[model samples]
Target: MSSDDHGLLPAELAEAARPAIAEARGKPARDAARILAEAGLTGVCAQEDDGGMALGLSFALAIAEEAGAGQLRFPLLDQILLAQAFAGQDIAGRIAAGEALGVIGWEGARDGLLRLSDDCDCDVVLVPTGQGADLIERAGLTATPTPLLDPDAPQIWLDVGAARKIGSLSGEQMADLRRAGEALYGGFVTGAAANALALSSDYLAARVQFGRPLSSKQAVRHHLARMKLLLEMSRAALARSLARDELGNPRDTRPAFLGAVGNAIWTLEKAIHLHGGMGFTWEVPLHYSLRDIRKIETAFGAGRLARQVAQDFIRAA
Candidate 1:
């Protein structure tokens, strides 16, 4: 990736997101989605020919990180990945224009009724069925509200029928798209972990006990150091993966993305502990960060399943 593109795009997008974050806070999710769309944030990686900026994988990850930092309620990951996957398709233009949203059933979801993400008024759901992109119009599907770990991210059950075939993707291409999803998840976790760490650090510095701030204690300082270390390492790994993606080499990203996601989870989980009992409650955003990270970690595949996939990818490399 060009050095200029690496830092500049993310920096500008993150800065531009400040007001959008404020506007989205404590409001219905549509407001957040609208804010992101209005800022051109929703279409960061969309093909320019399809009315999108076509910002590439690196920018897409940056957008995820920035959006996650604010705990943005929009389904940005879904939108960006789907936009890129379905580029040149009819729905792509609508997705770029913010006129519609898209979701993907990436985990072995083919035909039949399936529950995708929560209700975002998705216009189409793309099921990666190995052969090609199968498009299920919202009209053809039924959505029922479902619970989710991240309140910002809603879920719904869709009674999918025979979907209209729109495009095709090879197995390798589908795997790459899945890897992109994981990377985007990592980026989000990185942002959330960083935010949580900052919150805990600030809390420790301000929280006084035994005539000294909690941060004065060596143990507390160690926690802060570890959190910082994890955040930096994850960022570095993601940067490397992005560099590879920039060079048109997308393989082996799964390992780095998984490693980053695992580190981010640990960092945020510890961040919660550092906050003590208060962290367990809704009074602080730590709970939200922790919840979201944990959920995203397991979304596509969890525990041994996720590990095996990563190992397989690494071994094949």
Candidate 2:
């Protein structure tokens, strides 16, 4: 098998998923989720016993990248990662059926509550703990949606109480889960960057300037080239990280995640610039991608988080 194929989806499965993903784009979030569920894309990495495809993380991440490209406002990552992290097989079954949504809830009690991830309108939230996770029901909590950078990306702070203990995750299990998260988010960044590049390239080609196509200019060509380079490098790094994970190498994944984030930011910015002011307007969707990247980057305390992961990896190594 080729290096790129390491733990990734088989060709048939990828092919089967593509059209469903395309059809889901621009649809309502829950509707899209159901569509994906119907297509069996939602359970790509879920266990076979749970009525899932029994595919691996690489397959999930590949689909996640496609989701990013389409910007199909659904909780694909949460379903694949957080739902699986949950203790009960019932939850897993619900996720595989696309009848439930899962989200990561922050640990600390903010005035007898915790804040969940953006766009988390779901039945349950998995609050990570020192041991495992606390599964909290949405009905038990009060959710107040907050304004965010990307309007499409909604968020909520919860007023919740004690949670039901599920089960504990071993250190190795926790590490693997985190790495899976990294792979999913990395795919998102890759898709966003790739989409931005495509958008900018298309705009430059069709747009006329100085009595000629903007893409005809050498400067524009160079900018496009740089964007392509950043995207490919980030993708390669992410692939390497995933490959390592598949090989049971326990290196920190933060570097690859951060690299993808950086590439997405740069490529999106370039795309906006190349669109020549039109990109900044809400009329165009390019700004939405930029906003999404920025929100995700800062929300995670990205730079500090990456550094800490690197240091931890170094010490362990």
Top TM-score model: 2
Best by lDDT: 2
User: In model 2, which residue pairs have backbone atoms overlapping below 3 Å?
Assistant: 119-154
Compared with the true structure, all predictions reach lDDT values of 0.72, 0.72
Cα lDDT tens digits for candidate 1, 215-241: 999999998998899889888888777
Model 2 scores a C-alpha lDDT of: 0.72
lDDT of 2 by residue, 1-317 (tens): 12333455444565567788888876776777788888887776676677576666667777777777776566677777754554347887787778877666533344666665464467776665565555667665667766666666655667766555443456555667777777778788788888889988988999997899999999999999999999889877777777755666655667888899988999998888889879888887887777767766754568788779778878989
**TM-scores of all models?**
0.86, 0.87
Positional deviation of residue 87's Cα in model 1 after best superposition, in angstroms: 1.9
After the best TM-score superposition of candidate 1, give how far the Cα of residue 90 lies from its true spot, in angstroms. 2.7
